[model samples]
Target chain A: MRRLRLVIPAALALAAALALPAGAPAPAEARVGGRPPPFVLPAAAGGPTSAPFRMGDHLGQRPVAILFWATWCQPCQQELPFYESLYQRYREQGLRVVAISMDSQATIMRAGPNARRLNVTFDVVTDVDTRVTTQLNPRRAAPFSIWVDRAGRIVREQEGFSPAEQNAVAQGIAELVGR
Target chain B: MDLRRERRGAPRRRLAAPALLALVVLGASAARAQSDLSFELPGVGRTTFSLTSTTTLRYRGENYDANRFDDDFGSLYQRFDVALQADELRAEARIDLFVPHTVLVESRCVGRPLGVDDPSCYLDWDLRPERLTLRWEPSEWVVEAGDTQLVLGRGVALAFRKVDLLAVDNALRGGHVRYQGSNFRFGAHGGLANPQNIDPIDLRIVREPQDVVVGGNMAVVAPAPLGVTLGVHALRVGFEDVDSIDGVTRSRFTDRAVDVAGWSAEAAGLADGQLALYFEANGLRRTQRLVDQARSETGRGVYASAQLQLTELTILVEWKDYTNFLVAPETTEANARRIYSAAPPVEYDGPQRLRGIGNQRGGAIRMDYAFLPGPWSFSVNSALYAFNEEPHRDPFEGVLVSHSWMTLAKRQEYGGDLNWSLDLQGGARFETLLHDHDARFRSGDIDRWMIHGRLDITVGSGDHAFDFIVDHRHEREIRGDVAEFQIGGASVTYTFGIPFTLTLSLRWTDYQPGVVVSRGRREYNFLGGEFYPSLEVRWTFEPGTYLSLFAGQTPGGQLCSGGVCRDVPTFEGFQLTFVGRL
Candidate 1:
C-alpha cells in the first residue's frame, strides 16, 4: 500500500512533465488536417508480383483515399462497393483509392475473395499484423476512411459508413482532385 | 487483512489526490491545445504526445428478485492512455484507477456464514500503470521493450493482443525484435505473460498469475508464377506452480512447460488472381516435472482454407482439426480471461457453443452472389462439427452437429435526399449426442436444435437516420428441463445529425425457472426476468470525444470478437461513460 501511494503520484507527475512541452512540428498521424503516417503493405493476392503498395509514392502525385476495413464488418461490406464506384469515376483525375484490410491472420484469406466479390478495381492491401492500423485508426473502427490531398495533407476523416455521408465523401474527394 | 481494511476505509481519501492531479493536468492541457501536443528537444527531432481518457460510472440497484442484495452500490473507473513519439522512438503508458474498493458478493454469500470479513467479499482499491512500453523502429528493423502484442501465423501457436470491446488485453512484458525485408521476414519475442487483473464488468480485482513465454516466426515469400509463401513458428510457455501457506508464497519454476511448433503455406493469385489458398499445421507437447519422473502429453492441430472468386460469385471453404491442442488451460469460469492463443472457429461467428477446442473437428463453406448494375446480394453458409472425448483413441468419434445460414440484402438511393438498406437473414443449428455404448440414442442422450432469424433496415440520407433491428431464436433440448424455449428482441435507433443518438430495445426469453439454479435456488434463465428492456443515449462532443449513458437490464451471453469468445454476465443497472482523446 505504501509503495502504491508513492508510485501513483510519481507516474502522474511524469505524465504531466511529458505533456508540458510545446511549439514543434507534428509527426505523421491519420487525422483531419494532418498528414498520414507512411506505410507499405503487401497487396492482397492479385497485384503484380504481389508487390507492396507504398503510401509515400502517391503523396504528391495523386489525392489518395485510404479505407480501413475488414471482411466480417457488415458496414464495410456495404461501403466497399460504393468506394469502387468512386474509384472508377475519379481514377482519371489522379484520385487513388486504396483499401486496407484489417483482418487478422486467421481471416486474412477472405480479403481477396471479398474484394473480388465487390469487383473493386482499386488496390487492396493486407495489414494482418495491424502495424499500420495502430498509427492510423487506434480505435479500430470499421469502414474508417482518410482523405489525403495531392499536397500530402489530410483533408477529411470519417468513421463508420452512412448513406447520408456518401455525398459528402464524394464531394470531398472531388474537391481534393480539383474536379 | 490490514491492507484490505485500510483500502476499504481510505478509498475516497486516497482517490482525492490523484483525481485532483488528473483534473489539473487535463485542464492545463486543454487550455493549451485541443488535440495532441507537439514539441521538440535539443537533439531529438519532432516529438508528439497524445492522451486518451475514458471514465465509467456504474450504479447497480436491486438486481433480480432471487439474488437481491441488501444495499445498492456504485463504482467509478478511470483510465488514461498516453503515447509519446519522437522520430523512431516511441513510448506508451496506461494508467487505471478504480474507486470504492467494493465487490458484488451477495450471490456467493447467500445462505452462508461468510460476511464482509471474508477476503472474497470485497475488493481493494486499485491505482496503477497497467501498461508501459518503449519501442524503436529504424528503417525495416523494430526493437521494442516492456509490454507488446505478439502473434504467430494464424495464431495457432501464440497470439496475444487487446480486444477492447471484450475487455481482453494480454501483453508480453519483456522484449521483442523484428526485421522486415522484401522477400524474407522474421521476428522473435520473449516475456512473462501479463494479463489484465481488473474485472470491470464484475467489479472485482484479483492477482494475475505469472507465466513465461518465448516465441518466434520466420517467413519467405516468392513472387509471381509460383505465388507461394511459406512460414514456420515455434513457442514455449512455462507455468510456475505457486503455493501460499500462512501468508508465505513459494513458486516452483520447473513445474511444467508447453511447447508448440508449426508451419504454414499460402498460395495466392492462382487461376489468374481469382483463387487463394492457405494451410497450417501445428504440434504441441506438454511436459510436467514430478518428484523423480517427468510426464509428457502430445497434441496436434490443422487448419486449411480456400477462396475462389468469379465474375459474379465468390466461394470460401475452411476446415479445422484439433486434437488435445489447447494452447492454454481450458477455463469455464465466466470472469476468467486466461486465453493465451486464439484459433479460428470454422463456423459462423455466433453464439453457438462447442463442447471444447481440445477435441473438435469441423469445416464450413460459404458462397456469395451479387447482382451487378444494382445493389443486391445473396449469401449462404453451412458448417458441420463434431466433438469427441478421446481424440487420441479415435480422431473422429462423436455426435454430429451442423449449422446453416443464408442472407439476402439490398441497398437503394433515391436522388440525393433519401437512401435505405435492408438485410434479412435466417439460420438453424442441429446436434445429436449418442450414448457411449448403445448404438441407439437413449432418453438421457442430448438432442438439440435451434432456428433463428434477423432483420435489419436502415433509412436515412444526410443529417438524419433511423435503424430497426429484430431478432428471434427458438431452441429445443431433449435432455434439459427447459426443453423448448424462444428468445426474441427488437431495437430501434435514431441518429440526430451525428451529434446525438438514441436507442430503445427490448428482449425476452421463455426459458423456465428450472433451467438455472442460483445459490441452490431455482431461477429463470433470464435472471428471474422475462423481459429485459434498455435505453441508450450517445452524444458526440467532437470527433474524438463522446459521452454515452445506458440504463435498464441486459441479458448477456457469449460475446465473440476477432474469433475469440467470452461469456459476459447479465446487468441490471445504469452506466455512464465518457471518452476523450487528445
Candidate 2:
C-alpha cells in the first residue's frame, strides 16, 4: 500500500513530463533548455580583447562560450590554460570565449596580472561587485561555463573544473560550433 | 475563540486551498511544452517552477522503551513552488501538504530532538501554502506582500528567520516597501507576525491570536567619496499569540504591543579596501501585562563589528548586548531566552534549560589566513562573555511570572580551525577540516574548562562525493561529576553518469550531562543514538527534474538556510520523492 501510494503520484508526474509535447513553453533558466541571458562587460587588463566582451555582440556572428571564474579558485587556475588553448584553436571558427572574473576591479592590480605572466592569453572580463554572476549563478561556484550557439541559445553548462571534464567540455564546444 | 470547537472543520478548510493549488501545478507542469518562457513569453523575463511529491513509509520500535515497535505509513508530503521575475515584477509562492501526524502525541523538542517531530508518531494531517509574495519595482521603489524574511545589520538586534527543518517557514503574512538611491536607503514593512498556527499544528484545539509587526528602516550613505553611512530603524509590534501553557491563555505583551527603535552608523575604506567598521544601537520599549497589572520599560543594546582583509588574511570582530526587551528574532540567538519544549516559556532569573543571546554582553574575534590563496586555509577565533548581572531580569525588573532566567556565566573561549584540500590525479580531490574550542567559565567563581572539537573529512572527485564528521564535547556543567559525550556522522554519495546518484549516511550520539537542577533537564539525553542510518538514490531524468528515493532512520536533524536553523523530526522510513519543473 505504501509503495502504491508512492508510485501513484510519481507515475502521474512521469507520464506528465513524458506526454507533454516537445515544444512546450518553459522558463529561460538553464535547468530546462532555455536561452541563456546576455551580458556585456569591459575587458580587464592583461587578457585577450577583440570586441568589448558583449555577449549579444556574438549572438548572430558566432558561437560564444562564457566562463565565469574567479582569481581565488584553484580549479580556475588549472583550467584557464586549457581555455586559452581552446580559444587559440577555435578563433578561426568565429568562436568567442569570454572569461569573466569574479574579482574587484582594483584587486586585479594584485591577484590578477599573473594570468598573462602564466601565458594565458584569452579575453578576461572582470565582473566587479558581482553584477553578472549574481544574475547568472548566484552560488558563484567558480570555473562555471555556459556554451551558447550563434543563435544565442545556451547548449551546455557546468560548475567546477577538473581534467576529467575537459572531454565533456570539448564535446559541448563541438556541438555549439557544429564541429 | 475555542480552538477545540473548531478542530473538526478547520483542518478541512486549511487543506483544501493548498491541495487545489498543488493539483493545478501538477496539471500545468505535465505539459510537454519544452520551451521556457524565454521562447513563448519572450520579454516577460524568466520564471521557475517545480513540483515535488514525497511519500514516506517506515517502522519504529526497539530502543524506544523495553520492547515496543510501531509500524506506520504517513506524511505524503507534496510541494509546489513557483517563482518568477519579469523585469521590475517578481513573485514566488510555495505550497506544501503533509500528514498532520503526531499532533496529539507529545514529543520533546525542547533543546534538540533525536529526530524532529515525526508525522508517523502523530494522528493528524494538513496542507498549506506559504511564501506567497508579489512585488512591483520600477526603479528606486519596491513593494511586496505575503511572506518575507526580515534582517537587520548583522541580525543582532532583530531578524526575520526560517528554519529548513520540517520545512518550517516562519514569515509574517504582510507587506514591505523600500526605496533606494546612490546615497540613501529606506524601507517600511508590516504584517502578521504569527498568522495563526498553520499546518503541523493541531489548530483545531489550539486557539491563539494573530501577531502583527510593523517597522521601518532608513539609511543615509555618505556621498560617493566619503565612505561613511548612518541610519535609523524602528518597529511597533502587536502580539496576539501570547498564551499560557495550562488552561486559560494570558497575553505577554503590554496591551499586546511592543515598540522598538534604533540607530546605526558605518564607515568603510579604513585602510584602502582592507578595513571597515560598523556600529548600531537599539532601544526597546515594551508594555507587559501580568494578570491585571501592566508595566512598561525600556532597554538599550549596542552592536559593533569590524572587518579587515589584506591579501590572504582576514580578521573580523563583533560585539553586542541587549538589556531589556530585545528586537532580535528568538531563533537568531545562540542561546534561546525561552525553552524549546512543546510549550516553551520565558524564565526570569533561573533557568532549567537556557539558550539565548539577549540581555548579555560579549564579543568575538576571528582571524583567517589562506595558504597561498588555495583550498587550504586556517583560522582562529576567541570570544569573551562577561555578563553584567548574575540573575537577570527584564527592564521592568520583574520575574517572568515566577520563573527565573540566567545566561551562561562569565566565560572565555579560544579556538582554531584549519581546512586543507589535496589535489589528486584524474581530478579526484580530498579535503578535511578540523577545529576545536576550549573554554573556561566562572559562575560564582567556580571556574572550569570545557573543550569541544570537530573534524570533517571528504574525498571524492567527479561522480562521487563523500564526507564524514566527528564531533564531541567534554565539560562539566554540574559540579559533582564530569562526563564526556560523543557524537559522529558520516555521508558518502556516488553519482553514476548524469542520471543517477546514490548516497548513504549515518549518525550516532550519546551526550548526556547532569544539567544544573536550576538550569533544567537533569535526565540523560536518550533521544538520539547510533541506531540511525539512511540511504538515498536520485535520478535526474532531465534538467530541473529529479526523482529520488531514500530510506533510513533519522534521529533528529537540523535544516538551515543562511545562518538560521530549525529542527527536523526523527523518522524511520522509506521515502520516494520527485522534483521537476513543470
TM-score of each: 0.83, 0.64
**Candidate 2 residues A88-155, lDDT tens each?**
77888888777887653213322233344224556777664353554454335577776677765554
Question: How many residue pairs clash per model?
Answer: 1, 46
Q: Taking the candidates in order, what DockQ does each have?
A: 0.18, 0.11
What is candidate 1's lDDT per residue for B1-582, written digit by digit as tens? 334444444556666555745653562342124443567866767666665666666766543333333225555566776777665777777777765313222233344432235644443455677668887877778888988767787777776765655666667888999887767889999989877645545344445557789999999978777778899999998864643311124433246778999999988778877788889999989777666677788988888888776767888898988787767632221233456666777766655555555567889998988775466778899988776655454334566678999988775433457777788999999876644536555523557888999898888777677888898989887655668877789999887654567899998765544322331242333434566788999765444445679998776555565345665555667887666555
Task: Estimate candidate 2's alpha-carbon lDDT, on a 0 to 1 scale.
Answer: 0.47
Q: Which candidate comes out best when scored by DockQ?
A: 1
Error of 1 at A94 (Å): 5.1
lDDT of 1 at B201: 51
lDDT of 1 by residue, A91-139 (tens): 9888888899987755676676566656677888987656566556655
Clashing pairs in 1: A164-B461
